[model samples]
Target chain A: MTTPPETTTASTAPAPVLAPPRGTRLTLRDASIGRQGTPVLEGLALDIAPGEILTVVGPSGCGKSTLLRTLAGLLPPLAGEVDRDGIPITGPDAERALIFQDDALLPWRTLRANVELPLAIKGVGRRERRARAEGWLERVGLDGHGARLPHRVSGGQRQRVQLARALAGEPRAVLMDEPFGALDAQTRAGMQQLLAEVLRGTGATVVFVTHDVDEALFLGDRVALLGTGTGRVPHVLDVPRPRDRTAHDDPATVELRRTVLTSLGT
Target chain B: MTVRHLLRLLSLVAALGLWQLLTAFDVSVWLRFEQFPTVVDVAREFGERVGSEAYWQDLTDSLSRIVTGFVLAAVAGVAAGTAIARSRLAADLLGPVLEVLRPIPAIALVPVAILLFPSNEQGIVFITFTAAFFPVMVSTRHAVRALTPVWEEAVRTMGGGRWRVLGSVVLPGALPGILGGLSVGIGVSWICVISAEMISGEYGVGYRTWQDYTVVDYPGVLVGMVTIGALGWLTSTAVEVLGRRVTRWLPRTESRAEAPAPRRSPSWGRSLAGAADPGPLTSTKEA
Candidate 1:
């Protein structure tokens, strides 16, 4: 296995074309979902690879969020099975952690406690949870603000804490639901940078959901564009060469953007 | 605070003094006949009323009933709000029933309470409870329902469960509205408690007020009304203050107004001007 360089800080290199590793992290087999008893996404089949970052971006109302919810087991598949490491997700299993678009930290709880929530649920003792949660806080650039409530932090900082919360749980994968949509352009960029930096080494497969074209390109290893609400498969985009996209936008990155927009019928 | 506010206040005082003067000097026969007891008569009665154990006991009775009913309503209201928000079936099942009962006045429940409960005291408490219950329930439901789906999904994505998400995300986001409801509910509860006592009881501020009115103790009646007013005013203020305290995590003006806005120099000078900061004169001398 040729591991990508730890520091993706290089100015230029071949774009990383991420593929599903032989070991499947999550498999959506003909999974379908609906609201008000109407089908949204139909018979979807996809394999999210271990240790890879996959993103879902598409036009409005195209079931991008629904797809994330389905994988996280927030919704039951109307048709088929969603298996995780050969085990089916029953309902909101802790093995796969989901991050919300807004920072969902209990306003009463400080940053550290919010990050440590999953551990608390698992009944991990106070000391170990605090140490790990603190480490993840620093990783997300919230080292000194652990005692601060969610309201005390900036939006971008709050999202970083949300990220730390998802990562701190040591789940098999991290699911995100347009976590940066609410942030301003500058903050969104900063959060994107924070995510890429923090999730770099962790082997947790991150399945990020967003409708923003630029964002998916900025952070995703492989991008899947959910078809317009008409129910279409978003042909996955293999991130173009010059693997280190942290610093600049390469040709494939721009083409990939055009492809996603076109796929969403924008 | 403004010219309008000052004008409004001056006009109010002027009107009161004018009315008092008219009553003192004997204006119109009908107006004079219907006039409120003199301020002096009301004051003396108020003092005499306060010194009595009966008045104190009535006040205590009404107050304890309100506190109990309000506490019950708050807890039950929050739980119902959460349940209705989370479970669609629960909302559908219970919503219509609550809606059906909500419009029936709590005072109207007196007869029903008498039939159902062992005593009039419980019935009065029940009336107070009913008055508070609907306000809190409606507020909580709407608060929970009005929440942005993005907020819940946001927490769920961040590794929160059904219970955790409700406790951490839904409740806090719904707090501002919930507090609004509690304030309104508490005020309404006090109003209902006095009214309940008035119609259904032998002892209470309301009953005493009615008793004084029956015998034409107009001064005492005026005193009873004033007592109810003061009690209501104090309790409402306390609820508002307590609600504010519990939700201190909310963005109070204190957070924004006290925020250290960007400045080249310390506004220490401004805060210290007749304020409690260290003395600038002392600092300068030390420097």
Candidate 2:
């Protein structure tokens, strides 16, 4: 992989196109994670390949979010190590972006401004920032609504802007905490499809946490089933056919889906 | 005009008519309406005062004091509040001192203002500043503290530093609450400034009103009262209007009521086109 020279000073990059971000290999080794001082999920061993989508589904109190937070470096691991591409994760980096379920778009900003936030933080110039933000907004199918505030747009549209904002940073890994869990069934499906569509060619690692079983099976290259309790190793399963909504009835897919449901004990 | 607007106007007219009737006929039903100035007498006094130089000087003096004090309070209060709320060190240093001082009535500081400042003008301004400062500080502190943590996190994950998070998220997020404090602060400043003027002022509407009372010019006193009322209303309205304009991004339910209905029925076609209906999006659900 040829890495571009670090542009410490602002560069007037002509085109809005960014070099496809290289994905980070995330590894969790017997890591204990939780909020404050207490551990919620413990003794976990997992290796997520670069450029893979890993959907985590579990019971409500299973600490799926805690695990994601630890990976994002928002929370420190209680024990063991969490690494990104062989380096220990100590703090949140721009290379690892987190998307929330609440559609955490700043309510005060216009959709375009919201998308431009990460870029602005990166010290991108005004012209490049606007061009890139508009590009991302268009990519999310929210081209004309850039001028509207977050409250003016539909919940799904806001989620799309959130997605655009997350992607606009061109993070090597995207940690999503039930990002589409608030949407209606149809909108959720539409968003899921849109997620798959937009994620193409970006090469960003995605760790998606959700409660929906079918959603896990559909979008994930691999599904990690996290059972409740301390010192539990999550059961990981690989989907035979990923990103195909019609593969629900496939025999192997059906078997795996049943296993996930049974292991989750729902 | 709209019926609501007309009704508001009618309400004000009715109030004036009742006052006029009570004073014109000298109907003293428990409250001494007989001794009070008649509506025509007060109106004539107001006309005379408006044309006089002394009245305008009083008006300008009071206004300048309020304006100077309120502006200083807004700047200092927001800074101090933001610091106290955002930093543990600042909170520990200043919180207790401010809390102890906050409870004393700002107008009651008239003696302190008179003793501390070299001039009555400076003293009155100090009282006005004191009155407005606490409200703005307390509201701003609450506003800064109440900001959602996700915004800070979002900024941090984007590689923003401490100052970056403050400038980008904390200030704008707390702005609505700060503006609320400002509106209340302006009103409180008016109250205390007028009272301060009454106590020690040489040339202000409050001082002039007390002077009118001493000489038994009931109509002139009523004019002073009316001038103070009009000025207070105008200033407060100005603050409120400015607040609304700055926080225009806030979701307004009233705007939704006036929006045109969605041209097409809820269909998958619009969804596919990613152009969902503009109706309250919350009401739309896929069955």
Candidate 3:
């Protein structure tokens, strides 16, 4: 795959229609991230080509969420740094959106309002924001349920709303901290499929965190197997192109899944 | 009416009947029944007092003082609480001072208020302000502090600054807590206003009650107590109704069967027992 030259500054505009195949390039150079002041994960040297789906899989408490937070600029890096294009990420910016594990739909906002949050924060006009939010809701299969409160929707539907909320802003990079972690197995599969389809041609750089090895392989262009003992991603395996459910049963993917499971000490 | 409303009415009647029975039998063993008025006596006095201009003035005076004080306290308390919870500098500077003052009962401040204010009216208003302020401040602080971090971060990641975050996330997110505080604040304001009026004010239901007691007009005192009780109930109901209207986005857990049951009825019992429960603050989730 041909990767475009890294843009020197953070780009807020949606990717151009006739752009190169790759999305935003996210580079973590000798990065160390942790909760509070202490570092849990260190020496995380990795680069993701723009629009590439990079999934990090590990055991519980392996700091997959922390890595996502660090990249999203929600949490400060304990050491080293994460750069988008060539610009350092010091704090949260609209260019990066984190889809939380708990769905984190504002309890007070309806599904559409929740999805409209980023646009609202950006001062988008009411009519325009509402229309864009409705379009996203429709895109996420929540067309008629925009008026429902976040708590009124099912867990899977809430996650869908969260995805719509994240993507509605047209962020350059999406940081997902196990966005489907709370859903049932069937629902998780459905979400994985939907996310894959929606993100197909956008070329938006994605860093998806998950514990399920099968999910990591099914969705990621590259699966990074993180070790619990050291909190470092020791193995990185590249999957064949057009990664999806069909790719899940590919001989290379099956072999890589076993490698990831073994690395996670399952 | 439903059986619940019937039972509530029955309970009221039973209590009144027991009071009348005590008066009729002149049960003066523990407390003197002769000193207390009968239900009929209180009812007659209520009818006479309700028709009097002086009674109306007293009612209006008590209401105006409590309303003004409560409104001032709600606005100031919410602002202070939000600042304390949201800003580290504000929290450090004002938090400890408020904490020190919070535990001092509003009634206990009556003497201080009397000395501080230029007039007894101002003193009474100050007491009511003190009584309402703490609950509003504390509950708002709790609400603001308890806000999920993701909500703020969600706005921040979307490029929202301090003001935008406050307006869109913090204020609205902490609204249920703020409303909870307002409910408790209004109830406490009545308590302090009545006490302050009884102690120093010239015209108020509380002052009238004390005046009636001094003149041995026992039935008139009961009329004052019932008036205060009804006034407190009406004000608190107004706050709750306003809360419901503003927070319409909140998921209502009320079942069809539970819809007819009044939240205020149980609250009345709780308040009579002296503001024990803080009532519902975060039960906005659909059951």
What is each model's TM-score for chain A?
A: 0.85, 0.91, 0.89
Candidate No. with top DockQ: 2
Model 1, A26-121: lDDT tens per residue? 888776776555779887778887878898887778888777887887787777777776567667756677777774656656778878877877
Instruction: For residues B1-287, write the lDDT of model 1, one tens digit per residue.
Output: 99999999999989767766765665676555354576667778888878989988888888888999888998888888778877999899988999899999888888898899898888888888888888898898889888877556645655567887787678877887888888889888988888888888768888889888888888888888888899889988998887776676554445553345421232111221121322121110100
Q: For candidate 1, what is the DockQ? A: 0.14
Q: Across residues B1-287, which tens digit of lDDT does each residue of candidate 2 receive?
A: 99999999999999988888999999987888987888889999999989999999999999999999999999989998999999999999999999999999999999999899999999999999999999999999999999998888877777778898888899999999999899999999999988998889989989999889999999999999999999999999999998987787777777663267532343322453355434433322111
Cand. 3 Cα-lDDT? 0.83
What stretches of model 3 exceed 4 Å from their correct place? A1-22, A231-234, A262-265, B1-11, B17-27, B247-254, B257-287
Candidate 2: interface RMSD in Å? Answer: 7.5
Question: What class would a CAPRI assessor give candidate 1's docking?
Answer: incorrect
The runs of at least 3 residues in candidate 1 whose Cα sits more than 4 Å from the true structure, single-residue gaps closed, are: A1-24, A103-110, A125-131, A147-152, A184-186, A211-218, A229-234, A240-242, A246-266, B1-16, B34-36, B154-161, B252-256, B259-287
Best by TM-score: 2
Question: Candidate 2 lDDT, tens digit per residue, A153-183?
Answer: 6777888888999999999899999998988
Clash count, predicted structure 3: 3
* TM-scores, one per candidate: 0.81, 0.88, 0.86
Task: Name the best candidate (by lDDT).
Answer: 2
Instruction: Tell me the tens digit of each residue's lDDT in model 3 across A1-266.
Output: 37666532446423554564345678888988888987878888888888889999888777888888888888888888788776678898888888888848888888888888899888899999999998998777767566767765568778888888989988888889888888788778778878887887566899999888888888888999888755465588887776567665788777877877777788
Error of 2 at A104 (Å): 0.7
Interface RMSD of each: 13.3, 7.5, 14.2
